[model samples]
Target: MDEQGVRGSGSPPTGRFRRGAAWWRSGPPWVSRWGAEGGRDGGAAWPWPSTLLLTVFVLVGSSFAAHGQEGERAALDPFARVLLLVAAGLLLWRRRHPVAVLFGTSAAAATYLGAGYPYGPVFLTVAVACFSAVVAGHRRAAWAAVGALWAAHVLVAHWLYRWLPPTGDAAVSWGQEAVVLAWVVAIMAVAELARARREQWARDRAERAQAARRRADEERLRIARELHDVLAHSISVINVQAGVGLALLDSDPEQARTALTTIKAASKEALGEVRQVLDNLRAPGEAPRAPAPGLDRLPELVTQAAGAGLTVEVEGEPPRLPPGTDLAAFRIVQEALTNVVRHSGSRHARVRLDKAAGTAGDPRGAALRLCVDDDGPATGADAGGSGNGLAGMRERAAALGGTIEAGPRPDGGFRVLAVLPLDGATAKEGER
Candidate 1:
């Protein structure tokens, strides 16, 4: 019965050492289920020495009890002795079969008492089996076994001693029995509480893991959006230049050469930025790359736009800006120039950057202003009404605690104006 219970409880089929090897070779069932196979090497093997010590103590204690009482020893029948031994043997598999051990040992102890044998070893066996049941996650079984043993003790003692007159001294024995029962129930209650705590901890750990996964998915989506918005415009420019080069290769050699060069430069820059983003995705442990296209790169950006046949002029010097502010400034300029080439149908464009003392006590300490004016016809034609380019530029500036205004100027041209805070040190530090 104990063997059957051990099998039913899903314990390892092999010896403790072999089970430890299996647990190490392929991680425990819980870890494997979560796809964390092959964790640490091996946990501590089962403590065989403790089992050996318990066995030795039980055998020696029973032998000593049998030797000390002559009449009790003689009255013990062979069947009773065998039952006691079976009860003791059941202890070997107690951890894997607590319910079966409790039942079998309780029944065997009852039989031993019925056969008129000494009750010392039988009582000891019941105590050990009850404790084992409580420790092995079988609180309900432990309570039931305690009740059955208490009932059997009362019935057997009453039946054996009923012929004698009652001395009215039942209070002490009843008190001892009550104390023992209370102790066993209290121990089982403590174990149950501990099990509940462990379950709560497991639930908390699972919730934290789920939240982390959700956060990672959100971050990935955000990164994808940024990549699309930043790189798509450059890719579109490259595509247009490549198409022009292909069409003019046979009819206009010099124009085709210029277009090819522009395409090559645009493609190279796009590949570099894309590679940086990909690297960040693949190896998150590495430090991040430099900030993407800050204000410092504005000169090269303007030169590239000019090479693409749009005349660009820069005026005025601005105060140093925060990293995010600089990035926003660069992107606004890039998008504005791209719009000029793609939609404005303008031959000349001017970019102005200026810094001035704060007015109206805005709390930014200093104000940085940017203006882009294009000498193009104000008529809504050639992707003029799309508004995507202007919206993107405005979003970039607004993200840096700035505002933008874009519309047709009264002088028959288009204009974009933005005002951003220069003293954003507190905001930048807070982000870090």
Candidate 2:
């Protein structure tokens, strides 16, 4: 009845097309409750060619059956042709009003047979309606309508024929009814198989949609963390230098000029990094204008901290690293230092890097340890930070099969410690 197939691909209609589609999908409440089945267009209009063809076939075929039956049944007349027309025409609404069509077609068929019209392809209309209703999930209605029709036909053929049209006819045998029952069962069985397949396709589509949404959400979170690490550290440095410049604008003009230059450099660097991040967002597959910052840029961090009135010391040489691990490592250190400048009163901090188990003769990948510490009593400013920074740090580390620990030190200030695998393969092997 609704052979248009499964729902359309996921790109939804838009503008007037979308509105018109919504209107099509809407229908009478009873149809929804009956669980009518159709294409995405909601069985909006009649299937004219198919319905007309069926009506023509049944009319011609019934005429031949009537001629052969002669006196055994009533002759085909205007009333008999009207019954055929009614049964076939009901199929036009089979997809949108399945249950109604099922009963309507069966009723017309039953009345025609009760009046003693010869048996013919007029039963085809009833079979089509029954198939549509069963596939549309109106199983009980489809079964009842066909079942009641068969029972009524049995009563008419065996006993009631004496009181009905074409009097003096003998009762028909039971073997014919058994054949009719077999046809009914076969039709319902095929409809059930189709319904199961449709439901499975719907389930698969839902799971795929859910997985796609999950991936999109994770990408957005990663980009947000990237933007935060880039802007927060540079902005803090600019804020500190601006304060120093303002304090000595007239009293110490030369020192003030130096502070102004530091702010300019910090702002320019921040802008360049922000633009780079945006470039990746806008044209993801294109090569970057510049490489990502890594341990090689550690000196720049030291110089920026100096402008912010803090002294930072480096303790170990940077290790050879994978590109992903290198970018994650740089962001972790940057976030840790930003926390130190904003939350700790101490003017000094230390950074240490170590290849925990690597050596010239070792063939296996090694873990890299990073530590940032400051001597502090809390400054209490917190710089209005949103508190996502430390959580972001932990998430980045965990993503690469690494760990991070950040808290106040037992002896004096705060510390951020991280240990990361050299590469993804090493991380997975370690996990195993």
Candidate 3:
């Protein structure tokens, strides 16, 4: 599932990093997704914020290099200024062409050093390029840039030491070379860390969004089952009673009055149950609640079905059940009887409950078995096989780590049998 939105951090990044982060996040969606792809050498690759930062680094380093040179000798020539500008400008496309950027920047920096220009951190541009390339997942190009630039440095140093005299306390030393190497390594490490952190954050966010979607789906299913049960059973009974009232209105006034009263009672009951289901949506602390139906309500259910002209027979002692199991049992029976009233041509149905002996690997030691059957047609819509009712029963039973079998029996009727564990071990499994 896609994340609906991102929650901002309570404590966000600060200082220069914060500013950069803001700019980075402000870009269009595609920019962020494309950031780690092939840079300058491929498509439109200038992630503007990063390019801007690189420009600033390059300009500052160039100025320092020029000033240091002038202090030691003379100001930078126009050619050196132009070369530095060109190198910095090329970094604008670094993301799309990282390898090329690394190579071009390394060449410019090397040329500036070789020609005896001011050496005041101008090499920082090449270091930044190498870091960008590595973090963009181009390891070979980054390492190659590092090795080539270091080689250029060695050659430039050798040339200067061999011919040019050391200038006014500015001679390069072994310690300075080690420090520069360390700076390159440090930049690489920081870039790698940033990339890892970013990827991990994206993964965590995706997982949270997926979990939220799954929870929403489950809640919808539960509400759907509630609505179906409350409406199907009660509305069905009321519908039947209303028809009887109309049939008796012309011949028997007292019988018609009784039919109307039955309708009134059924409607009121349905409205109450519907209200209860809706209240489930309220805030947990504010919503008044009631216990869900269980086997104890079976008698009332039978009476309701009888009023609808369906004869329902109940048998066997109701087994002790966990809340989830009990509610599921009641729903299974309720849905089955509703099917009988709506689809089964026959007016009679049987409901059976029994204790199922524990078998091997049965953790509950016993299970509660529920079976509802009707002497309806063996096939067609009247058979009760083609409806959401059976599917809901199966889902409920499966949620409790049990199973339901529903189909037309060989003896010319439809049957729905479910076995649910009563020990509560699997009751919570559905939530998970």
Candidate 4:
């Protein structure tokens, strides 16, 4: 049968060959893609250059083995030469069908030896096939190939010792058998080790990819929070003042001028804050260092809101906090106040800050409480908001081990209350 048709026509479709074929193909999907050309890890193409080199090695070795043998015992006819060519050709399919190719080449080489041809590294084809199967994660097929070769060795020795003259290393001694076994075992060992290393590399690459995705998610959330804080409060104030200026332009020129000035100041502050947010996008080492806004800025925040026509009352002292907690607290208050200005209709709003030492004698625990409340008959401006403000505040507070409660108060206003843990937050930030 021709080489291309041999697999289907010359062999039984059941038993060891069938089992081996199934096992070899059942490996990780990537094994099939491992060709000698064009793929990710290694190409799955026929490694022609290497196969040609190995063919030359075996043929040259065969010639050398024949050189010293006496008589017509070592002479090769056209048929014997074709057998060697067939054996080498089968090796070209090694990467794609390692188990099948190994068996085919080994059978051809065994035929050559059994026919009294001079021995060389004719078994080199079998060794190559065995190694390829193992590296492709086909342990069963590789070991099966080795076992079949050993069986072939025994048959070849029994057949040749009786009729043919002993050529180079052809004696059927136990030492020769031992040496053959040792060589096959060594090649299998090396192939198994290579398979292990490749699998480990794949796993490590997957872990690194997952880690990068997680970091990207965290960075996206941080940027969203910054944009919300920078734009929400400032834009709300500016919107209100702009409306006031337009309303008073002719009737009350002096109040209109003051309203326009407030609009200008709010816009300037918004611009500066947005610039800081943009600067933070720079490479870590190049980013400017600035103290993050915290509760200490509440007084300024109140003044800004008052100018926007909201009457804000501030009470109690805000406790010292870790940077993360401080930022969370500031944003919670800012969002609450912004919502009041934009959504709540009442002019009067109240903000309160207080510290709570956790359950009596709880040496390791304390928290800061923040509350913002305003009477509501929310205007149509609230409808234009995307409704992400309160959700963003909740996410920020949760990140620092805090909780936020926000809903309409029974007395006819909306209220936001956040409690942020302080005990371990600062220590954790310091460690980081």
lDDT by candidate, in order shown? 0.65, 0.80, 0.73, 0.75
Question: Over the stretch 198-271, how does candidate 2's per-residue lDDT look in tens digits?
Answer: 77888899999998888688778888888888888899898888989999999999999999999999999999
Q: Which prediction has more favorable TM-score, 1 or 2?
A: 2
Instruction: Find the candidate with the highest lDDT and give its number.
Output: 2
User: If the candidates were sorted by their lDDT against the true structure, best first, what order would they fall in?
Assistant: 2, 4, 3, 1
65: Cα error in model 2, Å: 6.0
Candidate 1 per-residue lDDT, tens place, 166-253, comes to: 2221222777767767865675666677667767888899999998898797567546544654665566567667777899999998
Q: Which stretches of candidate 4 lie over 4 Å from their true place?
A: 1-101, 112-125, 158-179, 358-364, 377-381, 426-432
TM-score of each: 0.55, 0.78, 0.74, 0.76
**Across residues 7-124, which tens digit of lDDT does each residue of candidate 4 receive?**
1122322121122334333332343444224333333644667777888887777777777654545576677778888888788777767878877887887788777777677778
Pairs in steric clash, model 4: 34-44, 35-43, 35-44, 35-45, 36-43, 36-44, 36-45, 37-43
Question: In model 2, which runs have C-alpha deviations exceeding 4 angstroms?
Answer: 1-75, 118-121, 157-178, 357-366, 423-432
Give candidate 1 misplaced runs (Cα > 4 Å). Answer: 1-172, 222-230, 281-283, 289-292, 298-432
Give the Å shift of residue 242 in candidate 1.
1.1
Model 2: lDDT of residue 332: 87
lDDT of 3 at 231: 81
* TM-score between candidate 1 and the true structure: 0.55
